[model samples]
Target: MTQLPLLEQAILVLAALTLLASFSMLAQSRLTSAIHSFAWQGVMVAAATALVAAVGHAHHLYLSALLTFSLKGLLIPWMLHRLVRRLNMEREVENIAHPALVVLAGALLVILAYWIALPIERLELASTRNIIAISLAIVLLGLWLMIARRQVVTQVLGFMSMENGLFLAAVASTRGMPLVVELGIAFDVLVAAVLFGVFFFHIHESIESLDTGKLTRLTEEEPA
Candidate 1:
């Protein structure tokens, strides 16, 4: 069997690294560490995109790489760190479920992705089926993270993970999306993050915690 090219291998490896870091985030007990892992994952994705762009001569992918590096890698992580500090949420990263269970769920997601990808093995693309499956797993795991956590910050991280998965899928299917589309996505994400940061502060000020249950309680108590 002919092997995947070096560029293809690099892309697949980096995608795997991103997925692994996301799973690690599910199990990490400290907010700072989860933030660091997320940053590293972003850098890995950016590097992979750059590698693919270089190998395949996709000029627009360079912009995608830049977007990943600047937005996901640097800006978002820094903002999250500052947001945590400002909101005094720089403590433990609690999981509503057991850490062992969380890890198991992530593993199942990966297995499911690979299993589903097995049916589409005929296409001669660079990691097409595997990457798509992994991307879907990433999206589902991110949703799981949101459901299995009480903290607003963790839910925000889950949303970011979903976005990462979408980007990964785009890369796998098309090598890269257009620069304008990537830019638009970046803009929307930035705006959403800023809005959420403000909302975080408000939630903290009102309840002295970043838990979603507290917000639900607030909603329940309000007069209809």
Candidate 2:
């Protein structure tokens, strides 16, 4: 087997960490552990970005690393923790299905993503192409988490995870996108989170729980 260079090795290690984080997200039933898993994923992403920047001598990637560490790694997860606490819904998270099944489904998604990304090799650097597979898999897993679960809160968390995967894909493929673009995405995600926060209260009041089945009541009317 050919020896991997330091940069490639670093990226691979980070990719593995990301995969683990996704699994952790899938496995976690409660809000606090899920938030922690997401934070760890952000940390790994920042470390990977820093290592890549050092190896490639791309100063912009260093800035990207710092931004990721602050926003996703710290701020957003912290906000999620506080939000859950304020809602008094910390230990009350309800998964629509068993966690073991969810995790198995996520594993299948990773395999599918690898197969799906195989043809995209024509578009990116060799290392980037492989990383893209892992990135897309994470995104898919996030989406699955959103769909498989009933709680709007968990769905929002899944959306955030999806954005994280998108960020990883951008960095892996392009060594980080333009600063303006990155900032735009960050702003958009922040706005989305706030919107979800508002929605959480609304959902709670209307349905008494954020569960999807309960949300169907929003469309039904009590006949007078």
Candidate 3:
């Protein structure tokens, strides 16, 4: 068996850490802790992108890594922290309906992701194929997070995490998207964050709660 290069090994390690971070975010009950986990996941993804850039000699990916670190790693998390404080949800703990069961479901999703990626892996298109599986797992896990969690803020975290997964997949599979595309994505995400912050305030003002379940109840009652 041919040995993987040292940089590729490091990239794989970082990819695994990124997946672990996704799991951490899923299992986290506290809103702040989950956001922190998400930030670290972004950092790991950035590191992996940088390593991929180094391995593939794709200079554009280096810029992608910087953009990811700036937007996903630092700016988004900082914005979320401020939102949590402003919304007075800094100490809020979301109780997962069945924590163990949800974790088991997440594990199943990971396995399924690997299974789905097997054919692509056979092609041996790139050293990052395994990371593609991991990226799919991250995406599935993010979707699962959105389904399992009830808090609007947590759901938003899941949504952003899904974006991270997509970004990682692009880097792993194709070395990175065009600079213009990445910039567009970053801008859209920032606007979404700001809009979500506004939505949180509106929800809080309307019902004094951030639980999404309440939104359903809201529609049932006719406005006065």
Clashing pairs in 2: none
Candidate 1 has which clashing residue pairs, if any? Answer: none
Query: Which scores higher on lDDT, 1 or 3?
Result: 3
Q: CA lDDT of each candidate? A: 0.82, 0.83, 0.92
TM-score of every model versus the real structure: 0.91, 0.91, 0.95
Of 2 and 3, which scores higher on lDDT? 3
Error of 2 at 3 (Å): 1.6
RMSD of 1: 3.1
Cα lDDT of model 1 by residue, 53-172, tens digit: 887788888888988999989999899999998766787666555778878988998888778766655574655457888888888888988888788888888888888888888877
lDDT of candidate 1?
Answer: 0.82
Candidate 1 — which residues are off by over 4 angstroms?
A: 218-224
Identify the candidate with maximal TM-score: 3
Runs in model 3 deviating more than 4 A are: 218-224
Leading candidate by lDDT: 3
lDDT of 3 by residue, 16-71 (tens): 99999999989999999999999999999999999999999999989989989999
